[model samples]
Target: MRYTVVLSYAFTPAWLSLSRDERNAMEEQYIQPVFAKYADQVAARFFDAEAFHAQHTDFALLETEDLQAYYHLVEELRDTPLISRQYLTFTDIRIGVEGGYRTFEVLTRARE
Candidate 1:
């Protein structure tokens, strides 16, 4: 099975002021490790966030054999400063063939 994941970040107004490199550094330092930890179950094809917008969105395509393991990985990394809201969307291509994208939204608050 394989999964394509997209992550979006809903950023606060203050967050938008940061430079692209600043935002990228945050992910590279904090978020990337979380994903790398689960590299065996999920492989990231793309990881990027828009730094000039009030709402920053990070998108990624992941290939995974175990859905549960992927879910666990998402759950673990949902609250980091690099992201506000982590949305995991899964698409099942077949019983064994499943892939989806995830969107992580970086926001000011946890619920928003």
Candidate 2:
């Protein structure tokens, strides 16, 4: 089954205070590689909630058939400075909203 993962996160003040060069290097040397590794199996998208008057700072969508890749990505990301330094605080993980009729079917059946 295909999976849709929505990861919502907020950035720490320290993260926002980083130099542009520092931020760029982190994205290039760390973050992007994580996505690149799973690029073929998953399509990743980023949304900046800060511009939209939202609670969270950022959002990411990951769609993949290979679930293990998702797990690995999370594990790897957890150790990055973005996470370890508490820069990117993960808020939630939402799964399977885009599961077509199966989504409705499952929710309907569970309502019994």
Candidate 3:
């Protein structure tokens, strides 16, 4: 079964105070590394909320074959400055509903 995790993150006061360069450095030094570590296990997509939504600053959608891999990735990310320095003020995780995308995948496989 495929698992999908959708995240809606709001910016914190700490993040708002940082300069552009500081944010870039944090992404390069901390955020990117966590994604790299889980690259083989999960595929991630990010959306800048302003373009499509008004409630959150950014959004992350993660897809993985193993649900545990997603949990591990989140755990590692929480340990980084991304979470520690309060870059995110609020977070909402939406667990996938198995019957939606999974149904399409299963039917496609059956056709083959």
Global lDDT scores for all candidate models: 0.59, 0.87, 0.84
Model 1: lDDT to the true structure? 0.59
Task: Tell me the lDDT of model 2 at 72.
Answer: 92
Maximum-TM-score candidate: 2
- TM values, all candidates: 0.55, 0.83, 0.81
Model 2 agreement with the true structure over 1-112: per-residue lDDT tens digits: 7889998988878988999899899989889998898899888999888887456888999998888889999998997888888878887789884667897788899998
Q: Model 2 — TM-score against the truth?
A: 0.83
Worst 10 residues of 1 by lDDT: 86-95
lDDT of 3 by residue, 1-112 (tens): 6778888888777887999999899999998999998999999998888577667889898988887888898888889888887887546889785567778898999999
Pick out the ten consecutive residues of candidate 2 with the lowest summed lDDT.
Answer: 95-104
Best by lDDT: 2
